[model samples]
Target: MYINGSWTDAEKKQTMEVINPATNELIQETAKADETDAAKAVAAASTAFPGWKKTTAKERSSFLLRTAAILREQTEELAEILTAEMGKPLKEAKGEIGLGIDYLEWYAEEAKRAYGEIIPASSSSKRLMVLKEPVGVVAAVTPWNFPVAMITRKVAPALAAGCPIIVKPASATPLSAMKIVEAFDKAGLPKGVLNLLIGSASPIVGELMRSPEVRKITFTGSTEVGKKLIEQSAATVKKMSMELGGHAPFIVFEDADIDAAVEGVVNSKFRNAGQTCICTNRIYVQKSIEKTFLEKFTARVKELQIGNGLEDGTDIGPLIDEGAVKKVQEHVADAVQKGGTVMYGGEQASGCTSDKFYTPTVIADAKDSMLISTEETFGPVAPVFTFTTEKEAVERANHSDYGLAAYCFTKDIGRANRVMDGLEYGIIGINDPIPTTAQAPFGGVKESGIGREGGRQGMEEYLEDKFVSIGNIE
Candidate 1:
């Protein structure tokens, strides 16, 4: 645990054992901080607030630029650590490191351009200027999936905007985040500019949300926890930015290139073993091309190699833990029990002999009433359905409370744009499957939570607007 400008251990004598989902062994531990630790972190950030916020953008960006460089130097080491801790394939983990580095670089450039604007006033002698300033201390509560990138998503912009941050990384994979702090700290980030704690959700979160010194709550986690944080933040009226749950829909049209659409759909659903918030969980294919798409997609999915992430040719790895595997198992079992068709990969992987590994699964004839269709699987199960009309496909895709991301495949440019407009998602990819990038805005709508991350919009989230009027009468 890191608090105030130093690294400390949990005085509570409690810790969470981080187990490798790939091999079912305890890899390391994270401090399960108590309310005292959380309070101490908040107090430290509060104390450092004035000085950090007063620092020039150029100075702050110097630290961020150095951090990016350090990230590149340790990319391979950090990527390996992320793979062992979070169970993502080594390739995906490496991809995450690159993305994290990209985010820091983007924000570093964005820092020098955070300019205030002049507003029009009635009188020529009077001038109204609007300025954007840091919103005090920020408490960023991030989830385990995509651990490295999540920290960079929040910390990069928050630091660039000259705001001190106290981070609460998910207990399962805090190691990646800790390594990130190591890089930033090595880059000579000032004391108190960044703090970190790993613990249960209750008091650690409770203390931060209740503290008036913590001016904002930036979270990327489940919708249930996000709402609770929203309620708690009401007391202090602290600002918030949440990137919550998502069950994305993938729609394929009749005229789409059959082979291309099938390839895109499978990759979209099974990437990261489908644990991604913006992954395509429910796929709607046009009836005219349904049979051909499934035959090819199922065959391709069956050929994927499932093994330990360190292996050279392994395509799929285990989920985060046994609980995640069980959840995916239950969802698939329930769907089968409710009359859905399991086309392929419905059980644990034979190659991965761990309790946390589940085979990539595909289901057909799944109705909206089934839990698998409506709920987020957060695993490697893909439930697919067929639609006759474009309108019907759009309607079915928008049925869920989650609207984080949606995908559609069509060669017809006009139809692609039209469907993209109608789909109720923050991120939409026409021909592309994986749409996340540090250069673009990443966030969701509805049950997926509020605000955005990445790009220029992400940098602006930490800023608060103030208007000043000046009159020259000389």
Candidate 2:
């Protein structure tokens, strides 16, 4: 772990092995930090916060721009490490690195635009000004999926807003986060401005939350975990931004082009082996075109080649571990028991090196009562249900406690507008399956998460507004 602008071992000198999920082989070992290390990192951030907040926005942006260039130059090396640690395919891994670069570049420019406001006062002699200031030290905890992108998503905005950050990356994927820290260090980032640590979540998070110097926490992971952090951070009342779990629904209306819908679903559902938070979990098709949609969607799913992530022409890779495979199996069995038909690829693959390779699956005649419908199926399984009308589709899609992202396909602008407004989600994709970008506000409502991650809204989470009034002056 890189802490206080230096590459160092854990205080306890303990280490953990990083395994390649594709082959279940040991890739490398990383330092395992404890509460002591967490304190060191947090103290480093706190010590740097004052000077970092004093620097001009353009000065901070220069470091971010340099880091972005370094990331692009080392894309191949970083993508390999990411794919080996997490089971995403090499192509997707490269795309993730590119997305990380986009975040750094976008936030670098967005930092310059963190504008304050001048409010009009009732009295002629009174002047009111609102100033934006950094919220101080930040604790950033990111998850395993989209390892690099999630780290950049949190760190870029925080750094751009002039807050020093201490990162606690997911233990399952720390190497990717370490690589990013290295790039930032090489870009001449000030000492102690950014810190990284790897350890158990509870202890590290507890240490950061209990410290009064840590002013904010940004996390991306499961909703249950987010809630726990919310409870833990209550003592200090830290500002928080969470991008939690999602069970996104993809609705294909009768008026939509069936082929285009199939293509969209294929791209969104199978990317990263369906491990992303915004991937399509439930498919709602109009009853009139249910059969047609299933046939096309299943046929496309069958063509996805599953193998090692580093291998060329591999469409999908293994799950992160055996536990993920078991979860996918359990969901499939429950859906099958609930009368859902297994259309294609329901079981583990035959010729894979490990049992972690679950085949790309498609389930038809699915109902909302099944476990797959209610919970997030973070695997290569698609459980599809049919709807009779637009109202029924919207009702079923909004039935879940999660509302991160939702998608719909329609040619009629009136129907599209109606469904978009009716769906309860943070992001709505109309004929576009992948609705996330560095330029847009990325977050969810309800149980999905709190606050946003990208765009101008993301910078606000790390800033505090201070009101100043001047009277009887001039």
Candidate 3:
């Protein structure tokens, strides 16, 4: 764990083993923190808040810029650590590092643009001003899927907004978060400005919620966990921002280029073995092109080379753990039992290095009633459903409780606009597979999430607006 500008152990001197999902080998042991350690981290952040918040935006941004540079310089090393711990292919791990660097660099410039406003006064001698200030100490809890990227997404904005943050990364992937902290520390971050704790979620989160100094809580995880945190933090009434679970839908219209749609679906679904929150879980294709799309998609899915993340030319790697594999298997089984046909790659891979390996699966003739259709399948399984009309496609896509991301492939301008507007998701991709970027607002609607994570809005989550009215002034 990192706290008070130095590397330190937990109060109880306990440790948790970090395992490589590819081989289930012990990578290293990280400090396991409890409530006592959480309190210390919170105290350190609270103590540093006053001084840190007083610094100019430019001064704070300088540190972020330095950190970004260091991250780029050490990209290979950090990517290796990420792949070893999280089981993403080396190429994808590098991409995650790139995303982390982009967030730091983007937020560094955006910090200088956190502008306040002056409102027109009704009376001659009155003045009204609105100022945006840091929301005090922040507790950021990030998930394991994109460990490094998630940390940067939350921490960069908080730090850029002049708020001190204490991070609790997923227990399964704490080492990547620690590496990021090391970079920021090496870049001359002020003492107590940033902290890290690795442990069970309940106790640490409980400590943070109970602390009066901690005014904001930003989390990236499941909706179930996000709801519990909201309930727990009710007493403190802390400002909360959550990026929760997603059951994204990928739609292919009859008018779309079938080959292009296949490529897009493959890229979106198979990347990171579909562990991403925005990965397409339920695929809805227009009946006219359903056969062609599935044929090409299944072919591409089978061609992907699955192996250890460190190995060259490996397209897919193991899931995060045995539990993730089990969940994927359950979802696939449920879909099949509901009369869905396995188009390709349904069972676990035979020649993989670990038991966590699951074959890229594609289910055809899937219905909305299937488990894969209703739940967020955070795995490499794609359940393809056929729809006769645009109305049916939209209805099936919007049937879920989650509305994080939705994609449509169409050549018709009116159709594209119609589907884009019709979907309830927060983020939409038309003709393009991956829509997330550092400069865009990334979030969801309904049970998917509460707030945005990127773009200018991201920095706002860490700030509070203060309205000042002056009378009898010059």
Q: Taking the tens digit of each residue's C-alpha lDDT, what string does model 2 give over 61-160?
A: 9999999999999999999999999888899999999989999999999899999999989899899999999999999999998999999999999999
Candidate 1 minimal-lDDT segment of 10 residues: 349-358
Q: Model 3, 101: alpha-carbon shift in Å?
A: 0.6
- List model 1 lDDT by residue over 179-238, tens digit each: 999888899888888999888878889999889999989999999889988998899999
TM-score of 1: 0.97
The TM-score measured for candidate 3 stands at 0.99
* Position 175, candidate 1: lDDT: 89
- Ten residues in sequence with the least summed lDDT for candidate 3: 392-401
Residue 326 in model 1: shift from native, Å? 2.0
Off by over 4 Å in 2: none
Candidate 1 local distance difference test against the native: 0.87
**TM-score of every model?**
0.97, 0.99, 0.99
Question: 253, model 1: CA deviation in Å?
Answer: 0.6
Model 3, range 118-193, lDDT digits (tens) per residue?
Answer: 9999998999999999999999999999999899999999999999999999999998899899999999999999
